[model samples]
Target: MIERKKYMSLLEKWRDKKVIKVVTGVRRCGKSSLLRMFREKLSDNGVEERQILEFNFEDLSNEPFLDYHVLYSHIRKNLCGDRMNYIFFDEIQMVENFQKVVDSLFLLDNVDLYVTGSNAYLLSGEIATLLTGRYVEIKLFPFSFAEYIEALPDGTPHDTAYRHFSEKGGFPYTVQIANDDEMLREYLTGLYNTIVLKDVVARRKITDVMMLESIVRFLADNIGNLSVIKRISDAMTSQGRKVSVHTVENYISALSDSYIFYPVYRYDAKGKQLLKTGQKYYLVDTGLRNIINGTKGGDLGHILENIVFLELARRGGEIYVGKVDNAEIDFIVIKGEAREYYQISLSVRDENTMQRELAPLQAIQDYYPKYLLTLDNDPVVLHNGIKQMYVIDWLLQN
Candidate 1:
């Protein structure tokens, strides 16, 4: 397994703290592996075997513990009261009323807990009421470009690795079958079906699986385009599906809750507030996009933007599509009191393209650091106040 350094740093930082550590992401994004890896790290770092316990609710043998009371009892029996007991629970959402178990364990004076969930519901709505503000969340993503390159075989060309990362995306399992296109497709298709079945359809209790899949395809095909519920409903109805706006909105919400799609709203830089419309969705993994939209030539610029969007999300910030006057900036990232603007393009070698990409950044009046990232392999340049650098170089940089 590739070591997720950034996430590991987060886990290590929160280790042995009083608060519960919740690791969340889409399935196969390595949440379970992260917890297990950290468990090993604890043991290696002098934590006794008796002080640590790990359970994966997905395992059939652990079926009996699906009852919150039984699981709580089982964990209590393993506790070493004399020392801090380290506990790891994988896919805690699989247990019904699992938060009860979490609540009971958290009351103990000598316990440090870590839990992983595949669904966002683990931290939202009524489900998270029991542990609200008592736990810290670590949002994990698929392997990043830097981590992807580490997983590649020795001597793989940098450009070739970048192409593979762009095409297949950062799903950790994709690395094992990177050479086999046929097998990779089969894996992604099955994985997509599982996500819809377990996370979306079953969780939401929806009967129209086909309609939900269609919505997913639409979102995948238009990753960086505006996602209007009414427009989507009308488009489906035009094709004779006859769906309501309410239904479209519900389906999109389910997809977002399942961590399959992320919606980014537009930010008015001039007004310094989020706009009510013109939001866009980006997929969790591009490989899943290939399953919906066939593996063919795609909009390279949008793909780059999607990759950059996810990277920014991983960097810890409130991200928004920037709306400055009439021009649109690719991203407006605000971390604490600092704000950074980004414009992603496939290539800006053409003078017209360069000017167009620079326009949005130049329109911004403040000096909080504006960047123009492109695929053009040239020395970092500055267009007035905006810094132009290669996107690949930016992704690889520490």
Candidate 2:
């Protein structure tokens, strides 16, 4: 496995810290592999095997230990009192009342704990209230463009690599099956279905599978477009799905909780406040979008915007869609008190497109750095003050 250096670095930094390291992400985004990699790191750094305890509740063999009492007893009995003990739990939500196990384990001064879960259910209810600030959540994602480049065979052209990456997406397993179109489609389809069925459907106890799927398809098709729950509900109803606004909100919430889609709220750049309505959602991975929409998903501009959103997310910041007066800035990334504005487009080679994209960024006063990213192959240029860059080059940047 290509080491997930970004997340690995986080795990390494938090090693032996008092807080429980909770790794969360969408299924198939490699949370389990990341934990395993960190396990190796610990061993290589002189942590003895006897001092580490790793449990993956998803395995059938672990069924015997599914009871929190049995699992806690087994782990507690294995603790090495002479030295620090490292405990890693994969899919901790699979165990009944796992929060109690985590709380009990946290009380033990001898162990440094880590856990991974596919959805937000792992941290809600009793666990959220009990743990409070005792845990540090490290959210994970599929490969960044830099990692995507590293995963490809040595010496592939950058343009070719990015094209394939954009089409097939960054799921680690894709590195192995990308050459086989049929296999790639089947894998993504199965994974998407599993996420919807296991995480979204099962957790929410949702009955309308067809409506749930329709919602997924709608979100996949409308990435980067500003939408509200009522609009989505009305559209689906008109199409005969007949879902209530409350039901649509619940379904979308479950999807977000599963890490399959992210809803970015709109910020009033002029008023410096978050708006109550008009926000957008972007899928976790473009490959899943491709699988769900099939050949009908053609708008490359929105797809490119979707890619940039994921990239910004990996870089770590609060991202929002910015509306300054009537103009819409593609993204506003705020880190602490500072903010960076961005506009994404397929190309601004046409003067009209260039002006349309530039108008929003220019409207914002107080320079926090603005950029216009496009797929066009060109040297970096400045439009007034906004930096115009080749989107591929931007994605490959550290």
Model 2 clash pairs? none
Cα lDDT tens digits for candidate 1, 104-185 = 8888989898999988888988867778778998999998888999998889887788888888888899899989999998
Q: Native-vs-model 2 lDDT?
A: 0.91
C-alpha positional error of residue 372 in candidate 2 after TM-score superposition, expressed in Å: 0.7
Q: What is the lDDT of residue 77 in candidate 1?
A: 88
What residue runs in model 2 are displaced by over 4 Å at the alpha carbon? none
Leading candidate by lDDT: 2
Q: Indicate the worst ten consecutive residues by lDDT in candidate 1.
A: 124-133
Worst 10 residues of 2 by lDDT: 295-304
- Stretches off by above 4 angstroms in model 1 are none
